[model samples]
Target: MLQKFGFTQYESQVYEAIFAQDQPLDATSIVNYSNVPKAKIYEVLNRLIDKGTVLTTMHGKKKLYMAVDLQSIILKIRADFEKDIEELKTYKIKRTFTDEHIWTLKDASSIASNIEQLIEEADSSILFLAWNEQMDKYRELLEQKEAEGVHVEVLAVGGLQSSLTHKYSLIPMIEDSKLEPSQLIIVDYAYLLFAGIEHDSWKAIKTTSKPIVKALTDYFYHDVALTQITKKYGDQLLQDEEIARLLARLIY
Candidate 1:
């Protein structure tokens, strides 16, 4: 135990022997109690005395040694550690930017969980474009947002929420949207989540890029406009050269 305070093996044994004694121990007694070689007892005792852990007193021609308070030494070491902890805190600062880059979201359950978190955390608007499955999955969450006075807009087939929100069902894409099934959700114009169907599984990507948010909202608006155009012009929109080009490229 004394070795932890920088005492060597023989010095530690001698110090422990002195600590065990209620009265001081002379070099001969220290070597016998410590089980150390008699030739080495004076050398170890001298080192312990120099290190301030053991004090010596002259008894006739003999020197006797006793240990200092172990509790006081331990308390001093603890105070030094506490001082180091405070100094380390001076260099630690709160980070404003963290990992907001694009991240792969795996599995259907994980996708749903992240979408739920986005809805739960949104401070402003929500822009969503999805198919039947996602609409069924997150319907209650959307209703809760609406109840909280969040501006929620959804574009999907089976226009079930058009009455409660600024919702628009899909206006038939020029290239049929039924071929590839997917979901797109943007919240607060700061975060986006995309879930696309691939065979039996789903692949998703989440990001906090403002440019991506802007682009998605813009594309969603174009579809919203197209829905109005389809209502007004019907088949005649597919005939217009410019609208047809837009429909060809914009497959929402």
Candidate 2:
């Protein structure tokens, strides 16, 4: 849907008609074929043309409109979106971690897949601090890692009862906890993953270095102050507190 991209109803309809037709039509023809009002057809066509969804050419004294190739337009839209996202991510990295190189991921599936890959690559242990939401979604991945003999330590807003048939440990809720702001996963003392979701999509930033990972691991292990705060007021926090906490623990 182009709703999230800020397309209006008429604009979407015009664009869809053009995309479906795959051929250029004059404004009169568009009005007749699409059943849109004659008065509005020209406006729609001009708007679509401006947006690169339609192409116009002069045929005699009249202008003929043609649909831009749908595939090419879609690819261009996606490419532009990705480029903009990368620029935003670069700015965020510059402000947040000035010395670290950053990479951006654009989709939820990629975030899940990357988390799985990081877990699999762990040679020693996997340390995770997740909010309730992320734990619910990524529980299976953690279980799989545990099955592969990876030591898994998880701290979450709530407590887990049954320890699965794997090398997994869970810390129960602490009283008066202060929830963190993102999801975090550290792998084998070598890599870290920070992830978040917004508008039904997810993004992740990852880093790998033995020293950096080791320092993070130790910091997480010994940061009893943070641990205590998270334990106490974990539930009564932000809307995406769980996911944010998890990401923060892993990346920050």
Candidate 3:
């Protein structure tokens, strides 16, 4: 069990003996009992004492040694381990929520390639909203998926009127709406991609988590009515949506 926590052999033996003993024993007694060298016993005892696994007392002219509160030591170790595990879980949650994987691309070609990879890996469906400029690169991939009988729903803004004439199905949102240059694609509720475009910078983030992806998908679905009306009338009707009405009812 000690080895499982990366304890060395000598350390494990010394600790085990100390833990098993009913009372503390001097180095000589420990040497006799443990069959470790007398010279090595002092070193081991000192280390154990420093680790709070043993204690020392004065016995007449010489110092007597004893194992410290073994139960307390074990409890402390268990509590520390539990704390460490909790911290690790919290860090994992933060990493998943932040979508820790990031990629920086310098040009449109790289961006197109990355988006294509996301599409190819998608297993269920693709949910996309973007501007007309970026659509050209994804157009062939989208059409290919449609040819393969995969469902694709795109919400595009600006100048899709002419391009909307094609056989491929498309959904139009408000014209010149803030194009979601920030791309998000969730696949099979298991994988996710979030891409962003700034004035001169571009980045993509990826993650895979069933629970988180499902939660995000559910949140979107839960607010679908609000999302549709918001897209239709822009942010000006913030006070008129069903969600707003519910909040108002609660507040009043």
Q: Say which candidate scores most in lDDT.
A: 1
Listed in order, each prediction's TM-score against the native is 0.55, 0.41, 0.40
Best by TM-score: 1
TM-score of 3: 0.40
The better candidate by lDDT, 1 or 2, is 1
Tens digit per residue, CA lDDT, model 2, 1-252: 655676666767766666667566677777667777777888877877787878889989888877777688778789889999877643521123323555778876787777766765666788876556666676776777677787887765454433544222234433324433356778766568777655656767777655666676776675434555445655554347675456345322
* lDDT of residue 178 for candidate 2: 41
- Please give the TM-score that candidate 2 achieves against the real structure: 0.41
Candidate 3: residue 138 lDDT (0-100): 76
Looking at model 1, report the run of 10 residues with the lowest lDDT sum: 89-98
**Whole-model Cα lDDT of every candidate shown, in order:** 0.76, 0.65, 0.58
Q: Can you rank all candidates by TM-score, best first?
A: 1, 2, 3
lDDT (Cα) of model 2: 0.65
The regions of model 1 sitting more than 4 angstroms off are: 1-100, 171-178, 240-252
On TM-score, the stronger of 2 and 3 is: 2
Candidate 3: segments with Cα more than 4 A from true spot? 1-108, 159-180, 215-227, 230-252
